[model samples]
Target: MVRMAVHQSRGRTQIKDSRRGCPRYQPHKGKSLTFGIRPEHVTEKRVHTASSQVDFSADVQVVEPMGMDTMVFFSVKGTDICARSAPQAVVGAGHRMEFTVDLHHMHLIDPEKNRVIGHRSDDKAKTSD
Candidate 1:
């Protein structure tokens, strides 16, 4: 897990989705939270159950081609996130690219304890009644 912090409202992002539909990042109230995202989990624009996704448009900061996929880098909430993209991703620097995060695969940690305390789950997105 990586240690990170954001403003009260920074955890959420909004995408003026070209597809008209967009994903949402459910807020975390944990005073301290750390999380890790894998490149493969970062994919081309996609939509899952509304509560299970986080979609955003990011600047294509860097693209490095690997044997089968390209390593993409961009910043979100001031943290650089890396992604494994198709080798054919011709996205170059300065262009905006949309990315999707599948909540089922994400891990969250309690920073002080340095152990994973939760996984980003769609089930948690339900507004408490």
Candidate 2:
């Protein structure tokens, strides 16, 4: 269990996510996103505890699922990416995975809203009159 400490001028407050514990992600397979290969440059890094460190690239795409509990997708490149079963899998900052495409030339889509962010270079252009 994780405990967060909140301090007030008068006193202190301790907040716990759970007293005993709670299950991780529930079992439900409804919708999932399929990511492709993309390139990105290494941007930042973070040190965890005193031993481990995470490296992050400038072009990595971090995706948070709609309503699910503990499901997140990290897109390193167009075709290369990793899925985390638990949130604790990805720790620190600066370093995530690796990508082959630049940060500016990346595309992402939110199917639920029918919204697309970014685009592929080879995609057909839409001309406006």
Candidate 3:
């Protein structure tokens, strides 16, 4: 498992990943890699609480209400991030709201290679194939 310090608007949140032990990531361990998570994976409501789920709060910079879901815009460490949330759960811009990021769905990219190194779900799919 690897622990990453994510700098947020208010403070820093440590994200823990249980999949770091995967052999595929061993060589890249301790090297710089880009972290990514889909907007859908970052939600206002978490399906379950796991060690890989990180909770943090951010000020809403923009809110787009779609028919089925709402897209929320925020920033962390100067990087703009979007999160998909249930329309009813979305708060207006300028308001602080909490979000949970499911790291199990996160993707790690090798910066130099400019491609995805691996992710928890990807490893599972590859093994099954």
lDDT of candidate 3 over 15-99, digit per residue (tens): 3433333445556656766778899999995656776777788999999998999999999767789999998888899999999
Off by over 4 Å in 2: 1-101, 113-129
**TM-score of candidate 1 on Cα atoms, chains taken together:** 0.64
Q: Per-candidate TM vs. native?
A: 0.64, 0.20, 0.72
Off by over 4 Å in 1: 1-29, 47-51, 118-129
Output the better candidate (2/3) by lDDT.
Answer: 3
Candidate 1, residues 1-129: lDDT per residue as tens digits? 355432233445222222212123234342556767678988767656666677777998988888888888888768888887776654887888887776556655666666554333434654442
Q: lDDT value for candidate 3?
A: 0.73
C-alpha root-mean-square deviation, each candidate: 7.7, 17.9, 7.0
lDDT of each: 0.63, 0.30, 0.73
Candidate 1, which ten residues in sequence have the lowest lDDT sum?
Answer: 13-22
**TM-score of candidate 2 on Cα atoms, chains taken together:** 0.20
Q: Candidates 1 and 2: which is better by lDDT? A: 1
Stretches of candidate 3 off by over 4 Å are 1-21, 47-49, 119-129
